[model samples]
Target: MLPILDWGCAMYAAVDCLSETATVLLFDPNAMTDDGAAAWFVDAGSLAEWLETWLAGTGWYREDADEYEDVAEPTPWETAASRIAE
Candidate 1:
């Protein structure tokens, strides 16, 4: 399993196994601002592609945050991953 994306409050990731194609999962902690383990399988795709599609799609957008300016910033998890890769 490879850790792909972290939205600070949540995570979008994938797993690879010899037995199956890669599976993407979304681990959302604060679903609709309510407390619960709100996680689900997203889809099968590379992290980059998935992230790009998400950013391009309207379903992930929230009108209140000034058109998702927050999306431009890398999450703490992503920063750590970049450092580790370096």
Candidate 2:
């Protein structure tokens, strides 16, 4: 899988995954506030629509993206690290 290195973009994708009932790990060197997360969630619908439009414009979907797969839950230390990184 292609690794996501952008913190803000990763956070957005993580939320998107959560909204769709999937799991994701969000980590950022720079901290994000609760308000920031809330604001993103507030605009998630519009953001998702725009993302889909942009991806479609770039023919990204034609690349045959795989379906979401279930992954093992993170360990306590991993969860703590993810939270700290965020």
Candidate 3:
């Protein structure tokens, strides 16, 4: 009886482990994408480091938000132009 209970417990643990692994495997899009962008962007790195690297060489710093507040809202002309480009 004790041996049976141990086997049952081990089976239950193995099923739970397999369930979690399956969920992760199913949702991993990098396994499907050609360029593997997901793996590149989400590699072992700090969030701040990622953000800094992304914003580098671009003029779009968070500090510029206040400066552009007045012109932040898109004009109808700008929206129509963007839609046409898209």
Candidate 4:
């Protein structure tokens, strides 16, 4: 699992790579602690497509929240975006 965004609340967004696909898993702190409930699971395709899906907000990882406070800059996402530009 490659973590992309961390809220410092134990809730985080991560990418899980599988043999055939890549997925984004959003975990809720309390719920995960209680029942291992993932807030979101999205099949975002390959690494590049996953980044695109994230930016477009057309997948399971929607921009439902008003805003997200980044615990750190998501450098991987930036790197992926740059790759797409090339």
Candidate 5:
């Protein structure tokens, strides 16, 4: 993952470099799961989409709430990271 933007509040915008389209993933470090692990959400398919939401006041950052809770996962990324390390 290549982080491209620092969208504060413990969130960051990164690009999945391993993906074919370099899909963007929004990382929310504080949004833990049942086991208390951080997860990533794909709210924006691209930089443009992410910017649109931010500008339009419809992003997860807005209202200080996770609006796309049902739109994401965890732990899968950890597996992928281990695989890549090998």
Candidate 6:
């Protein structure tokens, strides 16, 4: 995966080189385990979408953004990550 954006605290928005259609959002590694665990989530469907969300000022990362409440949380991408890593 190639990281395109960093949200501090070890979080990032990355492009999956394998699928290329999906964007991976990573949380702080502190929540990760030692047993091949991950803090990755399948967030935006594409970089364009993520950028759109940012431009609209409704990013889920925002403290005051309504998207945080209205939008469903990104799903875990551990399976996809493992598959892609291979």
Estimate the overall C-alpha local distance difference test score of candidate 1. 0.43
TM-score of 4: 0.43
Question: How close is every model to the real structure, measured as TM-score?
Answer: 0.36, 0.21, 0.21, 0.43, 0.51, 0.74
Window of ten residues with lowest summed lDDT in model 6: 28-37
Among the numbered candidates, top TM-score falls to 6
Model 3 spans with C-alpha error above 4 angstroms: 1-28, 32-41, 57-86
RMSD of each predicted structure = 11.3, 12.9, 20.9, 12.5, 5.3, 2.6
Question: Cα lDDT for residue 34, model 1?
Answer: 36
* Candidate 3 weakest ten by summed lDDT: 1-10
In model 5, the clashing pairs are: none
Candidate 6 has an lDDT of 0.69
Residue pairs in candidate 3 whose N, alpha carbon or C atoms collide under 3 angstroms: none
What is the lDDT for 19 in model 1? 16
Candidate 1 on 15-82: residue-level lDDT in tens?
43321434444554444223222333444344555556567663343455456653332222222223
CA deviation > 4 Å runs, candidate 4: 33-40, 43-46, 57-86
Model 1 TM-score relative to the real fold: 0.36
Ranked candidates, highest lDDT first: 6, 5, 4, 1, 2, 3
Q: Tell me the tens digit of each residue's lDDT in model 3 across 11-85.
A: 210111222221111112333345332211111123343234335622222456556543232111212223223
* Global lDDT scores for all candidate models: 0.43, 0.33, 0.24, 0.49, 0.61, 0.69
What would the TM-score be for candidate 6 when compared with the true structure? Answer: 0.74
Per-residue CA lDDT of model 5 for 17-78, tens digit only, reads 77665667767768666543346666566666666666777655556456566422322344
Q: What TM-score would you give candidate 5 relative to the actual structure?
A: 0.51
Q: Stretches of candidate 2 above 4 Å error?
A: 1-12, 17-31, 34-43, 46-50, 56-86
* Tens-digit lDDT string for candidate 4 (30-83): 643232333434334356776776676654445553355432222223233232
